[model samples]
Target: MTRLAYSALSSYSRVQIMRLVQDHPGRTITDLCDETGLHANTVREHVQRLIEGGYLVAETERRTTRGRPRVLYSAATGEAAASSPIARRKAEEAARRGDLMRRVLPWTADAELPSDALHQIDALVEDLGDAGFDPIIDEGALTVDLSPCPHASADGSHRDVLCAVHQGLMEGVLTQAGGPLRIAQITTSCDPSTCVVMLRR
Candidate 1:
């Protein structure tokens, strides 16, 4: 295969490995082979690729028995593959927004909301409101809901416009927060003339 095709395939494999690691951290090569239904060799190949790509790291841990230690694999720390200029720009923007949230929100204090998700949603709503969005805070698996100005629309596709805006908004906000924001769900739909954004942070 060409270099480009190999790179694409490697990238896909890396993403698959990352997802597996996210779901089951500290998994072994045998575990991956079982989960992915691939041959042990194939699993090893993919895992090695991920390690070489700087997307994964491995450590050896000794079991309680008298046998030798087994190698355990896990996802790497720090950001990965911000290769393109646009992606780098987005990362920078997200970092700036996270800094703003750190300064404005009571991140240190445990929020009084019913749950952690609600607390994050509330924080997001407050931050968006402070940033001048007409937001409606909702409590659910997905945290904050938004209803930006309907009159601000130039075209009739208010839902699409609002979805894009809020997607950008959430990306910026979470990027600034400096960690992976566990987004359980995100649903964007239209409500009459206005667009509604439902998110779980």
Candidate 2:
């Protein structure tokens, strides 16, 4: 039997979700919530982080419903998700890749921000936290370190898309807050544990 260690590796909910998915590939988020007795939103957040970390895969489930499709998840490299648009469709540009990740990414049309630096920083932190980035803002340094990045990849190859989405999200929020700080460069780690964003005045 294989011995497993989980502490310091993942959050409690995330560990539970991954184990469940491994045991039951293609389990829907709702199914997982019921099994773990956790809230649906909590499960979804852990699942999203796992997916972003490349530890799990998410595919859409089809039903005759009018709203967003249900997502089925499994350990990474598991069987292709049944009816998954990403699994079925050809690879394309980041903007054109219509998937749940796109919808979750914190981005919208650009706007404006205030000249006051401190207020802008506070508002940006709130926005990022609401978006699940676990953000820590350093106004003196003009940088933010996001842990358990909801979009970073274990491999560096996908950083382009992941980093771009983060950049856009921050841009939108900062502009809306009336600070209009520009993104100087995004330093994504190959570790996939966190990513840092440096802002330009």
Name the candidate that leads on lDDT. 2
Encode model 2's per-residue lDDT on 1-201: one tens digit a residue: 211112212465565566676567888978998988999888878777655544456767787968888777866431233222321121121223223333566352122433244444554565465455787766556788887786554346644544543454455444434444666886766577767788877
CA lDDT, every prediction?
0.49, 0.54
Show model 1 residue runs off by greater than 4 Å: 1-14, 79-201
Listed in order, each prediction's TM-score against the native is: 0.38, 0.39
